[model samples]
Target: MLSWVPLLTVALLCWIFSAGQPYGLPIAVWAEDSSSLARQLVRMLDATPGLSVRAQLLSRAEAQQALQRMDVYGVVHIPPHFARDVQRGGAASVTLLHNAQLSTASSLVQRDVRQVVGTLSAGVEMQAMAKRGTPAQALQVRLEPIRTQLVALFNVSTNYEQFLAATLLPALLHILAMTAGAWSVGRELRDGTLGQWLGAPAGEAQAPARPSAAQVLAALLGKLALPLVSLWLCGMAGLVYLSQLRGWAVAGSLAWIALGLLLLIAVSLAAGALLAAGTLSLRQAMSGAGLLSAPAFAFSGVGFPLLAMSGSARTWAEAMPYTHYARLQIEQWQMGAPPAQSLPVIAVLLLATLVLLALATAALLRAWARPQDWGKR
Candidate 1:
């Protein structure tokens, strides 16, 4: 599962969101007026990338049914005499009934549809004013006295593939890393090889002899080295795929981001090792690993914003290294913060790794000295 699961999941997630943005969403339109103005707005709605006018019904009742059946995202109802209202210098209404359940799609459709209607309304008003002997420049100024430009500082395209997949890959790897670390150390105990592995040299004894704390730590590190290095390489490969092959922008120094990835891996591995050593049972250790890592992404503020969370919930999020790691990745990758700003988070991860490593080493050493605790399934 470890060898290919993360790769497959990450690839699947990327494929799911490969579309840069949501577009061509189906929307229903009902033009009660049957005027040239209503038809023009329908064409404009279809022209926008965010919406597709799937059906133009004869009556409001049919449009409502279409919306109820979910044949389309929403209905654009043009009330009767809409053109006459515009011609008579009176305000007209275009009613949009959208599916609130599909919030994101509904919002996008609403935005595009509103823009189309607003643009046409302005033009219709300007023409009416022009016919009434109003100056064109004065009409334009009166229509939009204070224009504003909305700009997105990061993830400008709002591409879900880049925004989410980039962060999701790390979370997947983190869970796997902790599981691998636990299994690496836990298996020795499960298989009854802890003594022979952590104690005296080959041919020195018939069974095995307990070694010093140094030997115990050495054995634990040596056993974990392979998996640690392998997962770290996997992390680097993911980074390369995202930033180089996929062409996702890396705002800050890639080198700093790489260091952050390394720290995240080390801390997760240490955490797993600590769990296994403390539990002294492979089954229990693996169970604990799952309970901790499985829900990590949710609490890591990847799916939800930390600022929006309750105070106690945010505190729980702060306690997880994945939270800090995620923050570091966003800071360096999306926010393009300087290396200096990233140091504190890096230090937090590094410190967590060290603390977990120390506690795991001590636990392993204790387990090494007690042969009774060696054989655990």
Candidate 2:
């Protein structure tokens, strides 16, 4: 029914973008002959757009080796007799061994090769007909498209698991931090627990002079350390797992990665504190947190390259504290840079966090200064 329109719309959109996207296609080729003809075909395919040739098997045995290893999408074979058969006007066939898992690119390669062969077959037929040779025998031309050379950049291996795992780590870290910080402060406000903190008897209080800003800051920092360390450990574990298990390459130093992680936590904590101060209750803070998540994700350059975004969107992304730290993380972790290079950026984030915490404390003070309605109580 039309009642499910929004759900259906989302589902359809997800399918459209996810289905048959060529960003992660893996294609492989194996040629037997290594003849001028075979070389020509290989060159053409290598030059062909969209497909990335991962590796070329040197022999039929190598092709078998690749197939057993499950290293490629498809294996192309140019029979040793291809050139002879074409010259003798007899039909020849090229064998393509393909993995069932990489169906999309395999199918595409199959169709593309067939189209090329069809064109060549037409020419062979025309020549035979012109020579009055009864247009050849059962088959015209048999030259099969074989393995092609492919050069790739950044993600040369074409491993989807590695790609996703690497990028998702930093994004997830920042997201969870944002959620935790926002929820923690918001929960206290929404549950009216803040009143308890604000209303504790002076003598009963735990050795403090009217709960100063420094005390609150120290308390929040102390409370945050456990979660912050946990998040940092989680990020490191993800990076290590991907690198060791999946062969994900990281371009940054471990120290730099740690710095980035710390910066991201700082950014989230600052944003959460600011939100807490602005909102009257936990419900409002939670709503604000929800509103911040999507923009933070989008602005972090996970969905699209920040530079490619429109003018205003690009500006917004640049302005976002999370965006800067995310970029620093990627550069430090995936790109493999030293920690020293990120010092200035980390310092900036720390300073910004301090500024936001100061602002939140100011707001908290203003709230505390408000005259109480003891009559109702």
List, in order, the clash count of every candidate structure. 0, 7
Off by over 4 Å in 2: 1-153, 202-209, 338-341, 371-377
Error of 1 at 198 (Å): 2.1
lDDT tens readout by residue for model 2, 1-377: 11233224323433343322354344566766766666666665565554556787778788878777877667777788676787688887877777766665676667666665566556665665657655345333323325357766455544444454455556656666666666655554555454345544443322233567875666566655666777766666656655555455576675666666677776776677567656655556556766776567678785578778999988888767677776676667555666776777788788887887787666655544442411111
Encode model 1's per-residue lDDT on 1-377: one tens digit a residue: 45566667767767777786888999988888888988999999999988998888888689878988999999998999998998777789999999999888888888998899999988887887788898877998988889999999999888877788888778877888889889988988787677677765554321355566677678877877776777767777777778887788799988988888888878888899999999899899899889888887899888888899999999988988788888888899889999999899999999998889889989987777666777767
Top-scoring candidate (TM-score): 1
Error of 2 at 2 (Å): 39
> How does each model score on lDDT?
0.83, 0.62
TM-score of each: 0.87, 0.58
